[model samples]
Target: MNSIKPKFINVLFSSRLIEVLEFILEEPKTKKEIEKTLKISTSHLAQVLSKMVDMGLVDKRGDIVKILPKGEFILGVNRVAKGYDEFLSRFGNFMNTYILDDIPEWLISRFYELAEIEIAERREDVFSPHPEFFEHLSNSKRIYGYVTVFFKECINFFLRLAEEGREMEIIVNKGVLDKIVENFTEGFGKGIERKNVRFYVSKKDFQVFFYCYRCFLFDILLFKKCFFLTTRKIFFANLGWVIVPNSKSFIKAIKKYAPDKLEEVIK
Candidate 1:
């Protein structure tokens, strides 16, 4: 219906309108109830509702404000736009270094599922992970991620998780698999040889590192811990955060990158 035409930009920024529509999306609402629930003054809400009607997004059937089909369309558009906006607002700095090309379209449309993102960074040492991240992660029973940068310590850290009986799956590009076999020759052959740890090698090269546990999803920056692997230039990843702990959004993205399609790395 061309609901996301140029003029829709204004609709995306109308927080009051978004709030009203989201509140009443399932049903209709009375004017007084909206004003009270939104804590908006009568005069302000009057103006907001008036604007909504003028845009043909809503209709006043007596005292109740009802969303029109057009309004539903606008709200849906705003939801997707809001997802991209939130994602960029959080990781915009990585644009120069990383690209989202590896991520597929079906998943990008559902980015809003990642709720309440909180950033946790490691300020003391760029080479190490934040201690608190490890603490929170200890409670998780399963861990899986796509790693582009190969660090023996990082590999060992995850190996320990497997040793402790936590199920582990580490996906990587061929570049990394080669390096692990080449560099950690003796150790890789022995430890990850356990049935608990499974590795996958992707057919495509991915710059963005994606990680998640059963507890939370984490989009991580690479830590500069090795150059022995294929000479792929890597940025130091000293920052990572909980992405809506226990949220389903990242599971989709993690699945998009990992799964039955990739080659399993067998020791």
Candidate 2:
């Protein structure tokens, strides 16, 4: 007879077989005895036992059946698999309830692609910037700053937000401000007056700083090559801005260490 598929047999025989195996290993049982004790029909029990025997999962000698080493291994693996499934089910429910459901919708929609990219990079041991950092910047209704490469994208989005009459305070480094003012002169000429825009010379201190309403604040510290985006609640330092709690302490530390560079544009 053809073998029963492993998938079907795995589900059908797992619980019953484990109990029967434990009982039989304590004392070997004939097919009729196993059927009667387990409350299974003899024909069905025989088919299950036959499949287990054919798969080298059990041993049958004359009328008696006993679990083989292979059957024990399968039992251990199935128990662990069941346990892991339960853990994942609870974990997924926790994330949906306490984490994913609480984030703002606008931030969620705008940064979905960037968030996915960062998650993929994290799996590969690569450094990809977090989307929450940018989302914080994008949603800023007060002072903002941008380096040269980021200036255009920042201004474009900022201008649209301004059209809706959202209050924004913006400060751009002198170098990037010049480029932005030149390229979008007509738009900026009219739009700049409508929004609070500040131009400050590039200083040796911090590169960028902004407050997101009163809930969070950010400061960008540029080093030789890499940059640090620091965030805080109120005004603390050591809080590095990766969207985790406890950023406020980090921000306090950075402010104390580098007061000159970290200018607060918004209260």
Candidate 3:
């Protein structure tokens, strides 16, 4: 008697063929039975069963075909394959509907390309968060900078730290001052408490000229979304500072270059 090898049995485990075998496992069935149960055509079912017979996965007697022990093993592999396919399908749909819905189309295309390039380059330092970056800022006594767009995540994080007694001095673009004023007022609550968060609005385009002492920069250029957040390591070796749209140079340059854009944001 020839010994049945696992390798030979594994060859019959294609996803489509496994579905056919599973139908037979539920009940010993002929080619016609498999065709009706699996919704495969007669010709396709015959071709697959023929291959399985050669691999010792199915035993055929007259019109009836039964799944062998080897066939059962292949069915197990089919279950795993089907499970993985289902998981990926659901996950893909979720990302398409939720996480990606708000993103602009042009940015989406660029983001995907950038992701591929980032994966290929395998640069470890790219977006790896350095706690020391924030630590240095917290230790600094004087901070001078401005921010544009006023990202909520960055503001909230900094505000939480400031509430815990960290001193942070920042300048913001005119476009964001009103909103920041509201957040600062609400965050710290009435009277002199809100004064701790000193904010200035500049008459120039803050986006083009803000600089920080702690030189850290990150750009998120997604479709219809182009923003950069940078922290500069200035002064002390371990201490750094950040700049936003309200930074002195930032305001000065905006006044010189794009003064018209600043008219609405300035105090």
Which 10-residue span in candidate 1 carries the lowest summed lDDT? 226-235
- 10 residues in a row with least lDDT, candidate 3: 231-240
For 1-267, candidate 2 gives per-residue lDDT tens digits of 997666534633478767676667666788888877889987788777877788787899998887788777776666556554544453344344334444344433434322221111111123333445556645554433333233354467667766766554443444545677788888776666663443333344233342221233243322112212222322221112222222323334434554554444323
Ranking the candidates on TM-score from highest down gives 1, 2, 3
RMSD, candidate 2, Å: 15.9
Question: Better model by lDDT, 1 or 3?
Answer: 1
Query: What are the per-residue Cα lDDT tens digits for candidate 3 across 80-176?
Result: 5555455445335444433444434543444443332221211222333244545544554434445445444455656665566544455555555
TM-score of each: 0.46, 0.32, 0.29
Model 3: residues with Cα > 4 Å off, grouped in runs: 1-13, 88-267
Give lDDT: candidate 3, residue 102.
40
Which 10-residue span in candidate 2 carries the lowest summed lDDT? 116-125
lDDT of 2: 0.49
RMSD of each: 12.9, 15.9, 14.5
Instruction: Judge candidate 1 at residue 27 and give its lDDT.
Output: 90
